[model samples]
Target: MSNIIAIDSDIDRLARKLEHEARLFAARSRNAEAPRSRSWIVVDLEFLFDRSRYEAYSIAEGKDAEEKIRWPFHQVAAVCWMKMEFVRGEPVPMIEGPFVLAAGEMNERAMVSALFATLENNPDAIVTTWGGEARDLAVLRRAAATLDLQLPHQLIDGSPYARERLDLCRATCVQADSVHLPEMAAAVSVPSKPSPSKKIGVLCEAGDWSAVRDQVLADVLTTSVLAVRHLAAHREIECHRADTMTAIADATLSAIPTSGFARKTFAPWARGEKAASQLRGVVYRAAA
Candidate 1:
């Protein structure tokens, strides 16, 4: 474990190498975007990275995000997946597993295998997630490289837009505030994540799998709901055809998304019909 924290050590080299590999894997995909067809899957994952004794000093000195990211050590601690069937009219998420990916050390090969298998099994899905491209899915590619395992066949072919993956974090527009997962859930009145980032490693060390499972599932559900809602809003605003809008509403939405949608559409509609007294008496302008 001490070796992991050493500067320019094997762990550091391997992590950065794997991350670079992940980037290469992404670059191999086709230039296509996910279609807004009211059918999709929402997924989320949680992992550990940049754990070092130096974190305390970094925090004490108020180090910025970029500085923090450069810390040595990277590992995938745990992973989870949630499947959404928009076409089938499933409103709730059906998350399969939040298994411990790192038993003693990070089980890079096995975790990647499971995640790849999940995506491959659902080839027809529009993979929706929050920060997945940069964090979760990308990390899998890196982990696969670290293990020298082949990436899933489907992953190497299509870009984020290729009906393969849809990252909701990049989709929703909230100029009023940045849309973090907790913030998005709060806007919808959904429950926030129970365990914080600092405590996750502690929990993992203590073998609290249930807590890990619950948090991952909560995040997945939140991502699923937000993804569906955001898609519906775009459809409502962008689509001209009534059939398409209705079909989308049926599949991706339970109620219309009001966060950005209302501000964009409803505000305009409300302004159009606002009543004011039509005073007829033009005040005889006293020659001033």
Candidate 2:
């Protein structure tokens, strides 16, 4: 049988290493000219697992039944993954295809090695993500801890930073006004249809896990577009606006109530203010 080790420990170690690298990167960025290139490297993560099959059953029925069941009822068995495009002030391409990790057999070490390999090859890159500050980055950090691997790049959670840097919430918080990542993709009217939902379970059920993963990457591309446009148009206000936009988006997504268990399972990622605050401090210090 494959060895089953606690993943949190690995995540702890990876977080430390990443924190170190992020500080270093922020320092370098501070010394660079203002209105820095919009180009950035991003890593997007999508986890896949069988929900209906693995979800725990309860004796009760309907809403009452669900109430009896524990939150995060399903255990994650595998993950579907991909890498994002890195460039300045342009929509980065979502790398084609995905790497699939089978349930109950993910080699944590191998996964971390692969992630680091990707990062090492792209030195001096600013890692970007939608909710990456809270979700994607933290998940990878945990995975690295589980695998005992060092992380590859400097991290930036574009969503929150964008809001804070650009004052988006106060200036542009209308739901109907600003387009969402998914909505932005639709507005652009990409030839391919956007995935049905961003939820991993929903995509897996539709047998479109790969497509969903790609959509997530595409969303990152949208983020890049918005990031650059905001920067170019309102160079002094982009970060605050982006952070507000991110906050708004997150609040909307969190209210969907698709899978109670999934909601609970991802609680930590959702509650990443602490980490985000810490990162912001690091950035400020690095800048100093």
Candidate 3:
């Protein structure tokens, strides 16, 4: 028999109870007009860029000189992946093959096209992500506006949305709740160390390609599985405590407010209501 590692027994039990609560919540939440089920599409974006070539554009110190100017063209390479997870079954991610686009390439259209393709298969699916509500989706929207693509699907941010509705963290913390990113990677048997790249470009450097790809995919898969577990069980694992299970649950719940923007943007989605804009406005206002 195959040995199955228990992700978390306590969280599992809590999840069962939570599922019961979720069902009741759903039942009460539904009016005569509400749909019987809510489908979801989770998305993650990966990009590879050559920073070596861009570093040559540095300017001498001066008021007129900018720190780092945007490249004339980004020499951008990107991949967008999606998966539809219902309340049941094994999750299979549908990934769009990586494409090379201009640094100036508008991403909004690409993101919308990718989402619409997923929606075409499941029209009722809500577009979701750990931080997509604040960051990823917003980036896509801006790119779409620049590229002229119409976004598809209603948006739901997993992190803040879950916190507001269920008092939980989004999938990232849930997946990493019981363990650190490195530990989670190990649990799933992913072979790559975390990168120091603060930006995707640096993260995706050619030197770190193999490890980065493995780590990124591992992170994505780990988070996806955690989200499914949360949905199915209704309770999160706290990973920080001495008791493995409680620690996992606590970690899962504690990850909710890590991002202020995510908290603000996803508040509506947690309540099972469509956000006025599939995207939520950023919490910090900056003069551009």
Best by the TM-score measure: 1
Alpha-carbon shift of residue 2 in model 2 (angstroms): 96
Q: What is the lDDT of residue 268 in candidate 2?
A: 34
- What stretches of model 1 exceed 4 Å from their correct place? 1-39, 50-72, 88-106, 157-162, 174-177, 236-288
List candidate 3 segments past 4 Å from native: 1-38, 48-76, 87-112, 155-200, 203-215, 235-288
Tens digit of lDDT per residue, candidate 1, span 9-74? Answer: 877789999999988777655223333333355566655554564576466777453465431334
Error of 1 at 31 (Å): 24
- Residue 38 deviation, candidate 2, in Å? 6.9
Candidates by TM-score, descending order: 1, 3, 2
Which structure is stronger by TM-score: 1 or 3?
Answer: 1
What TM-score does model 3 achieve against the real structure?
Answer: 0.43
Q: Name the 10 consecutive residues with the lowest summed lDDT in model 2.
A: 163-172
- Itemize residue pairs with steric clashes in candidate 1: 32-161, 32-162, 33-161, 34-161
